[model samples]
Target: MDSQLHIFFFPYMAHSHMMPAIEMAKLFASRGCKASIVSTPANAPHIHKAIESGTNLGLEIGVLSIRFPTQEVGLPEGCENANSLTSLEMMNKFFTAVNMLDQPLEQLLMEHRPSCLVADLFFPWATDVSAKFGIPRLVFHGFSFFALCALASLLRHEPHKQVSSDSEPFVIPNLPDEIKITRNQLPDYMKEETEFSGFLKKLDESELNSYGIIVNSYYELEPAYADHYRNVLGMKAWHVGPTFLCNEEKEGYKAVRGQEASISEQECSNWLDSKKSNSVIYVCFGSLANFVDSQLMEIAMGLEASGKQFIWVVKKGKHEEGVKEEWLPEGFEKRMEGKGLIVRGWAPQLLILQHQAVGAFVTHCGWNSTLESVCAGVPMVTWPVSAEQFYNEKLVTQVLGIGVGVGAKKWARLTGDSVNREAIEKAVNLIMEGKEAEEMRSRSKALGVMASRAVQEGGSSYEDLTALIEDLRLQRHCCGSK
Candidate 1:
């Protein structure tokens, strides 16, 4: 402990991975550990802002840069932007970059000689590199503890064997709660055999085999799943999440893009402000979740039926083919007039979620959005599009009991035989403004308090983080002398 304990951190190129890693770095700095983060040159600006924010608050965190091919293989330049490309394409490109990252990352490790490394999902190769350098590796899963368990179960069973690819309820054998998954709801990439599934499989296995694992979750939020990690997986893991606690002064904090509108911010927030408070339904399927026009029309009609003020952020190419607002209820916009704002581009989500007028969120239930909604003290209408979202929907509706999930019973689009427009309208109504809605809102507020407390000093997350740092340093030293 004489010299600063150097800890190297590397998050996957996507924003979801990078944000949690940055928060973890802040925690390390707060506890007197020196953090050196690694990322591609394109990602450097993001890390720079995160480091700048931490340094401004007297946290000691440094960043190291790595070079990635601007367009590796088939990925285009700036294809790593999470807000743009599909998740599968991003994964293929990202892991391709990971394979190439070893040498430069190795060079940094040799030069810095950090006590340990914290790596994100999708970098299973980190284990090999850590072994080479004799440094302990801690893998971070940026999703729910439940999702981790579900994923583990999927990998263990390899369910593609039991049911025909064309069948329904595609049961994942030997998991609790009769956990049934469908083909369409499986992660977009996992729908077929390809590089994406292989990459994810490697990440899952690497995480299970890592020296230690850390999740951006809390015991209170996911006690049972945390127990599963400890008893079943036999991995020393830490659940420290709702990282929003790091943002004490919510106001004046810059959006992740760092700029107001040019090139990144995209004027999304200014449009949101023009709508009425609690009257607008904010819809974002997250950085991923492409939609066909028919599905998009269903959503638009559902929102229209609610007749509530609304602000919608539609991703590029989300609408169904040949579909437009012409399919929307006639006179809808004219009726709502100044009440609705729809931006067909990138949205300043954190800012929008935190806005006082914003009452509810319709999100894909990504951990980032889950935590952000809690931090903003806003209720959510969970519309988990795919992957672990089914588990997340469970947490939102069954476990937390604070939010309404459109896909609580099923994970596919509403158009399928499973659910239709009536069901969609009903779920939306129950969540947006209905008899049970206020009680759900109250419950969400209560959970927000618990979420905040988990990240504060002496809280579960704080204690777990401390334990992780101590254990990591000790393990790294023991491995070094061997």
Candidate 2:
């Protein structure tokens, strides 16, 4: 076995995708592996900072930046990541730019010849590229085992095909758990034949041939789904996460768009200090989530009605003009004065969740957000907006019993359907003070303890990480001998 096994990581450009991979790289480096992460120039700063933090802790993690083919893809310069792109058309161009990196990535791998490659699922060609250099490629899903298993089952059975209407509910076939999903909740790629569907099909096939997968979850959190992915799906996989917990400070990586501009960290912390322990609700959607003006008004009214001490991070809406004051319900801010704190742009989510005053989270149920909530031991009021969030909502509300949904029956970007103030108020009540909320809070606290333990020495995720490093070393040796 190599004395210092070298592992290269390639993450998709989105913040949610890149952050986990960055943390995973730091984890590998902390375990005495030489870890390198590759990203476009525009996205490299955050990765570099994360690696620098790892280096401060004596981890051998480095960042390599490549020039994104912006002009070739007809995209504006610096439109390298998913969050930076403005429209679906630009998104398509971004994918094209990502695909164009195949040749450069192949050249980079061949020259460096790392022991293993950890890549995002978006890069189907990574398996082949790694194989060309005789290195194992482990696909990273950036999702929970539960969401992965459910989506895989749906793909295999195509149960949504039987439903004639988008509103019709259909039971996902061949799943270990009985889960019902409406047709509209399905991702756009899965609901109809599209170019992205073809891309995903290829990605799935590539994963089958790759070495295995590495998921950002822990064994105690989803033991059944982990087993199903291993035994039922017949894949070699490792669970070595809640990866963000690996960072000692847990200050959160600097986002590509930068930090929250609305309030100072000290001000936010001081505000929380004034509140009782577990008495505040923290509301934030992931980076990509946007709401219409009408929905924003509904949310403003709902939070006022909940009567709970809350801190809400409100990113500017797509249709918003001038100031956010125009988007909110008239006189809403004045009416709620001391009851709520609204921070515009990116809030320090990890920091906020870690605060003692935060009791529950109102989240879009993104995998990263969900895991963060769990690690914080905070219950949730789930409002799933898009992508795999709906499935993640199920994991929170039904499977884990640590969350209550806001009755979001359909999926839409920002325009389709609005969850009124009434539903939001009800969900908030359920998570904040309902009889069931007490039980959920207890369960959440227990799970948070488990999550924290899993990443520590002699824990499940810790052991898995050790095993993965050893296995990769052995595989490297085998390849070298051959």
Candidate 3:
């Protein structure tokens, strides 16, 4: 059963989900294992480009393209990934399109008969598909332990339902610490039982039934939560990440990561060269965040007022004229001049965070961005827009003390919450200046060191990864791969 070992990764059709899985696959490949990432045609290019370096180094990493039934589900063609989604309503259709991949993926399971399948949280069906072929399935959510623990508590306790108002804070019962959250801050699906809520219930059952979960987290970052996840909640998990760092050794590797057509890493790096160490702030929302024009204007004004060196990567949209630059203050770019760099499309995020000039990050608290900043030792002004970002905000500002929240009191997939200029300025200043800021920086640097240690020999993540690969090898032998 252990003959010619191979593993397959099927991540949700989002860059955040796919890239980490790619890195995880690379880690397996580097350890003399063969791995393949399964993706649709539209999303396979990203997987192909990301794995190029590892593949060139003679690692047996490859892409296994799967067909997504786009036309049947009524989503626009080429809408294989969530980044291409324009609205929340379209997301349902896109997922329906994704769900349609079950048959094709099942066929692959039958044909490949891989040792294990590491599937995304979105694909609860994979548990059964892999079981059909006697293959183990591990869940990858691209999140931290704290977020998962807190979410588990929320779903189990229903504390938010007991609260009187959206703003009324309720203690998330049975966590490692006392954490309070409001109804508004939770995902819209969690606020009440919806069609999606039913789906999440299925996801939870599948997770419990799967072989184990894979997290892009380290033991040191949230020791209490990690322990609680395994011990108290009774879940099997391996924290083998910040997975993106697995193969960052190659020269000019940053450019290939999260690559887009515009704004090369060299261009971004040259701009950072002029600034002093820990002087400039890097601002970026994750790909799915769509801020209304007013919110975008507020961000521009807030950054301008902060009087700090900054780089803002604007998320490109489908609008012909692009959601009105009139949202920007008049002559704003001219006024800021050399002090500010605004990249209209993709910016090399990992490269920018690792640079010497980056003091703080004003981030939307996406798990990848949060972990990237943590790895870089950059403190954050946590502006959580959607998903489990609010839970991550709590982890940073409350548990870790490496970030300050920007008073983002609401959550929506397409965020229209316009936090005032003052709140943004205050959070930025707190993360960048004063004794508190210095202390936060010191703490962040220490955590960054821990992150580095986690990936090195004898580290927790290193051991977990080794143990996981070996366990898969053993499982293949014992279970008898069909």
Root-mean-square deviation (CA) per prediction: 4.3, 2.2, 1.8
> Each model's C-alpha lDDT?
0.70, 0.85, 0.87
CA shift of 451, model 1, Å = 0.9
Give the candidate order by descending TM-score: 3, 2, 1
TM-score, structure 2 vs. true: 0.95
Tally clashing residue pairs in candidate 1.
4
Q: Over the stretch 299-399, how does candidate 1's per-residue lDDT look in tens digits?
A: 77777767666777776544467565543556666775777766665666777776667778887787888877766767778777655777677677776
Candidate 3 lDDT over 1-482, as tens digits, reads 34767989999998888888999898888887889889999888777878885454778987888888888888878888888888767888988887788899999888888888999999999999898888899999888999999988887888888988999988899998899889989988998878899998988899999999999999999999999999999999999988877766677677778757368777788999999999999999978787877888888998999999899988855324645466679899899888999887788888899999999999989999999999999999998988899999999999999999999998887673569998988888888899999999899999999999999889999999999988988887777634
Candidates arranged by lDDT, highest first: 3, 2, 1
TM-score of 3: 0.97
lDDT at position 463, candidate 1: 88
Steric collisions counted per model: 4, 0, 0
Worst 10 residues of 1 by lDDT: 257-266
lDDT per residue (tens digit) for residues 1-482 in model 2: 45789999999998889888988988898888899999989888777765665345577887877789999989988888888766778878889888988898998898888889999999999999888878899999898999889988888889888888998988877667788889888778888899999998998899999999999999999998999999998889999999988874544342221333457767778888999998999999888887777787888889999898899988774424654465677787788788799887778787788889999999999999999999989999998888789999988988899999888887875443579899999999889896799899999999999998999999999999999989998887787888
Q: How accurate is candidate 1 locally (lDDT)?
A: 0.70
Kindly indicate the candidate among 1 and 2 with the higher lDDT: 2
